[model samples]
Target: MNAFKPYPLRDDFTLKNRLVMAPMTTYSSQDDFHVSEEELHYYKLRSKTMGMVIIAATSINDQAQAFDKQITLKSDDYIPSMARLAKAIKEEGAKAIVQLHHGGRMNNPTLYENKEDIVSASAVPAPREGMVTPRALTEEEIHQTIEDFAQATRRSIEAGYDGVELHGANTYLLQQFFSPHSNRRTDAFGGSLTKRMHFIDMLIDRVNEVIKHDATEPFILGYRFSPEEIEDPGITLNDTLALVDMLKDKPLDYLHISLGKYDQSSMRDQTDQEPIAQKIQTVLKRKIPFIGVGKIETRESIDHALSLGYDLVASGMPILVDPNWGETIQLNQPIKTVMPDTLPKPLYDRLAKYRERFQQSGYEFPVEND
Candidate 1:
């Protein structure tokens, strides 16, 4: 036999084929964010051959329950279903991570049952249409938010999840506080990068307090943050580095850097997309993993990124267009990507099937709020 060659993607914590399945919103959960078998099928199919499977952004706290069919790690009732999904994927020998999330000013305004007004870093109503005006969270409530994340992190461990990812990208609750356009407060939580990042800082501190004992087992504490916002200047890549430096003490397992505003103009208003991930990787000199994503498709591009020193690459459109995307790319097959929103037939069919099967059972529409 030839000299043994180490598996290219096999690391101490994960034995993936070099892809971390980017979390896509399937909206396939039933009432209370319970993962339907349909949802499990979508994820399990990814597990068949992928390196790592990160569940889509599952809302972790009650106030963050901004979408329907989005899975939850907060509810005890949801624990068994989530645990089963986790087990199903892990039994296939793939590492499983859950993306935990929240929405601040951006809570979908159409959820019929939610009466409490959306809360945020400030009390301003979202400039975008449909979002309700939000009230600023009190200091006590701020502390509660930290505890909520800790509780969710604890739940992720209890549910047998290999890791938990904080969803801090794309102008969500955390992003909103970090966005100048969304947050206009003079308080300590605003005005400066260090102050602006207080929420996430607090969240990590609380999470550490609870999970400090299990520090050895890839207890991933990764955060996805944006380097640029649509028209906002509150948080830029420069400000981001300062905050990242502040967060170094948390000793995060990964620092996922991504860009693109939350609004429609975000991707379009760009001058030149500087392949942002590489630039960020240079700034982040630590040895912790660095993950980058946004419009990833082909293997060569991903390989190029890996060669350029990105710790991991995340795929979005390619996977959405083809569930077996990674395996197909590895096998050297040509793939024709389709725009799910533009096309008439397949996209409509998938969306209808997804909604009908999910909403009829009481899953909320992600774009609509309570």
Candidate 2:
């Protein structure tokens, strides 16, 4: 399949091409959890090349925030803020997708002024050192959380977005509710694998209801997920395969697998060498579009991903480093490895602190030596 060709979705929504901008958190929102002018500029700068741009994870509520400076869609009041972001991307001729998120156990209490206790499916702390054990939500709160997601979807529609991607990957609230390591509840929401998926299943149902009622256009809905977790007894390949089975026929436009490399193999079982994306695709069987992302930098890498049979490809860091990534690739221009001085300070500092990550990926991050 040609990478530059338009890909059509249900209800007449067609992507300009098979390339998408992966959702990446910038830590650049305003104090009130609204999109800052800097972030709008950032999106506007990066939106020109892709068929769709999935904005960084935005909190669904105040409590859902995982870090300081996260964008929120917690209430109707933030609609205009999001509308501006949607307009920024859409005006560039790319579809804008908001990633609706809740931090759950990953919520850092210090980010909250009062330091509220974080909630999860159970009272399990993340396996990382110094992590606090979270409070399990009462059954009532679980239902309320579902409603929160639905309301956020409604806001995204009103804000003029082309779609919303449920932020289920990256060990966030949705993944926490599904992971055996995080969700230990004995109720209908946890226990067996089937039970652990209850929260996600219900959440999807609610979000769909909102789309059916609120969306004036052919809105896109997608789900993103990690194929496995490194923690002991955490999500495994088999577990994710089962998840793909459940999500394949759901009211979704695509399934995006989060990974360090698009063709990465199983982490838990090193002996299983099959790339996890290919495994999930075997189960998906073309039921829904599959977006493959991870270190997809150059035109060659994008072509390689397409050779692997992905329906669409997502570009992450390359777009951040170079706003004109697509244009450069189309013109056979060299991609930049150095971090530009023009980025938002927080995002720049964060990337600078972790410059070694870029080096490890064979991408340079040469900063100006002032």
Candidate 3:
């Protein structure tokens, strides 16, 4: 349960330690969605103490963007942007991973002039009040979107990242296709459970194809997934377990189970006391390395997570607030709050606004400059 030990990935890379900086969006990119100087400085400050740093969800195409300042790899022009961030992380002694993503129905239409660009598995609105309904992707569009992810993978490889993580969690495009609540398609991409998973299956296959043909060396491929959804008729633990079974068979280097708490149980069935991550691991049966992420900041929580069979532990807010979280945990020292000067203005402002909530959740927020 030593979180500081170096762990080898299935690929050629070996993590310097088992504590990962989870992908958490700062929403601080430049106007054209390139990595800003602030982001590079942020990574440089934070990457020194982590094994792997999974960059926040980045748009694979123009239509994939969700946040105003989200990072993008939609075209070759953006390759330098990612390369700069990768250089920052790797130079600081951590494996750099870019999380490729599409927003789907969650995309804010205001970011696009053409509303039709906001598309998903079906023409359904997200299950939130006053949400905009999205256009359904045509068969050709679906095929192209799959290619978009492949192209994104190629770009990540070219950008000098050690790995690329498919962002299939958090109700994004990938999860939209898999969720019965959002997807109402009847074509080859929807219907039975297997059909619903067709998009992810093809997406993975195409990305792997790109990696095999394009990469000169072994490049890591990882998948992140939410275990369940709150919406009725939405994804359940059984569905996620089945997904885990299929993913274990894929060439993915690891599986990351996204959760709000490290040991959170089923949301769909409160009576099911077993943690959703533990269930997924049982289904995986050690076929793939699993990364468990959530409110894990202290050495005790990290050890607790490892004791539950997780191969690695990840933290988002803790790492964001304290750059030396890994070193603090390793040395059993108190985690200190970062100064406001270390964070991007927007991220700092947002955290400041939600300071109380973050503190309640056990995160140390950035403090004001003395």
Q: What's every prediction's RMSD, in angstroms?
A: 7.0, 1.5, 1.6
Of the two candidates 2 and 3, the one with more favorable lDDT, higher being better, is: 3
Local error of candidate 2 at residue 324 (angstroms): 1.4
Residue 19 of candidate 1: its Cα lDDT? 71
User: Residue 159's C-alpha lDDT in candidate 2?
Assistant: 98
lDDT of 2 at 181: 94
For residues 1-370, could you state the per-residue lDDT of candidate 3 as single tens digits? Answer: 5789899876468899998999988889998889999989988888999999999899999789988899989999999989999999999999999999999999877888888889999988998764588999999999999999999999999999998999999999999999998888899999888888999999999999999999986789999999899998899889988888888999899999899899889888989898776787788998888999988877888888988879999988887777778898888876656467778887787778778867886656755632
As for model 2, its CA RMSD to the true structure in angstroms is 1.5
Q: What is the lDDT of residue 116 in candidate 2?
A: 41
Off by over 4 Å in 2: 113-116, 339-342
Worst lDDT run of 10 residues, candidate 2, spans 108-117
Best by lDDT: 3
lDDT of 3 at 112: 81
TM-score of 1: 0.82
For model 2, residues 1-370, the per-residue Cα lDDT tens digits are 7777788956488988888889989898988878999899888988888889999998997679897788999999999999999999999999999999999888876775554458888998887665677889999999999999999999999999999999999999999989999999999999999999999999988999999999989898999999899998799899999999999978999888899899789989899898887788789998999999998877888888877768899888778777877777767677757556546677877788888887776767877732
TM-score of 3: 0.97
Better of 1 and 3 by lDDT: 3
